[model samples]
Target: MTRPHGRFQQAFAKALFSSTEALDPAMRELATQPAFAVYRNTVMKACIDALEANFPAVARLVGSEWFRAAAALYVSAEAPRDGRLLHYGSGFAEFLRGFEPAAELIYLPGVARLDTLWLEAHAAQDASAADAAWVARRTPEQLAALSLRPHPAARWAWFDDQPVFSIWERNRAQGEVTDELAWQGEGALLTRPYDTVTWQGLTQASCVFLDACAGGATLQQAAERALAVDVKADLAAIFAGLLSAGAFTAPSSSPASNERTP
Candidate 1:
């Protein structure tokens, strides 16, 4: 049997997420004041506020009322497991996928996922980017044998149906949202080169190359993977882009303790 305190806490949690009128009779009697409703409203508001901060693009696209309604349902169904609200709603994208109201918005889940990743990358530990100059000086054999380390904040996502990167950028940009775009599959790479997190749309070859590097493959291996994905991919341009974007960390100076391949 559950202890009284345990049962009370469970009931209180349920009531917190449920309607005010649904409170247990004992709890209701204990809080015989209109202030109780204020408390409930405050809790709900805090949840909504956190979701708003974490998913600004989604909120902007969905409009306030719709977002609030969806957020309310999400909060009731999936309360934060921890007090760290920054990382709250980790599963919100998945939640939106099954949400009846958002069912028609096929691009929503991908956008939400990208937003979540942005938050995560923003909070990740900082590290210096691999020195492009130093790598450029390496001999062909040396470069082929060396493996680039993944940056602490490096992240990428592939969208099969929507131009998620474009949509996210448009919504985040200043001024009115642009509706004139040819929706198509897109991939995005995110990294924190400096203070701010940045994202860029990627080609399939770029995605494959980065995926290979992130999996600890050598430069030669990653290049081969990229070529396998797209024989015509501009390997030089991809390499330059990755270098300029600071998507990798110097193997020797990696903050993580992972082994640096020879």
Candidate 2:
């Protein structure tokens, strides 16, 4: 009942996955062993470097050895689940939250998520940021239906109690911390228009809009949904804010495409 090629394919896959550690003797004897081994090491290194690059603040906080060890273990245990490595580390923050070694850095996961958003936004298609002219082109009814795609660089982050974005900015700019208010819990919106990645502090209602848009709702719907959290929420102002930040994508023609806005 066994097929020869199927068995070889299965064994080959196992070998490819075993690259993070070393090539087992059984795999080492294959004709393409050297190439496969190198490829595996490269994949592992890419993931490690990516984790390091995106979460540089975390690396700075935890130091190199510990970061690399943890990143390596993470990559080894969970290979990337997507073809695009841009947002592959999305789950990494959650992983860190649960990982034991970095237990002391309670906010490290949120920090990592910020870094991941920066990377993803930077990698998004560099369409010209939507202009006021585009906004002017739409009628009120069209505006009502006007869906937005958050700029390729838009990232929505939530924090329970740590003003992580503020801390990141201050440390990144090498500013001395004179106030303890930086630790207060707050969410953030990270956006990049070209080369600059900036994180702005956000309010709960603002976070609600972002999360709603991120859930793939239309602009008007996103606003209405967000306003449900607060009767006085400034829906128009928030939409303008998001547009100015280059957050939003037009509704795509693909009927089956239900991708969540980032």
Against the reference, the lDDT scores of all candidates come to 0.85, 0.71
lDDT per residue (tens digit) for residues 46-93 in model 2: 888877876777787788899999998788667776666666677788
Clashing pairs in 2: 121-153, 148-248, 148-249, 149-248, 149-249, 150-247, 150-248, 151-247, 161-185
Q: Clashes per prediction? A: 0, 9
RMSD of 1: 3.9
Give stretches of model 2 more than 4 Å off: 1-25, 28-47, 80-88, 133-145, 171-176, 214-220, 250-262
Q: Which candidate is the best by lDDT?
A: 1
lDDT of 1 by residue, 16-93 (tens): 677647677877664456787677779889999999889998999999899999999999888777788998999999
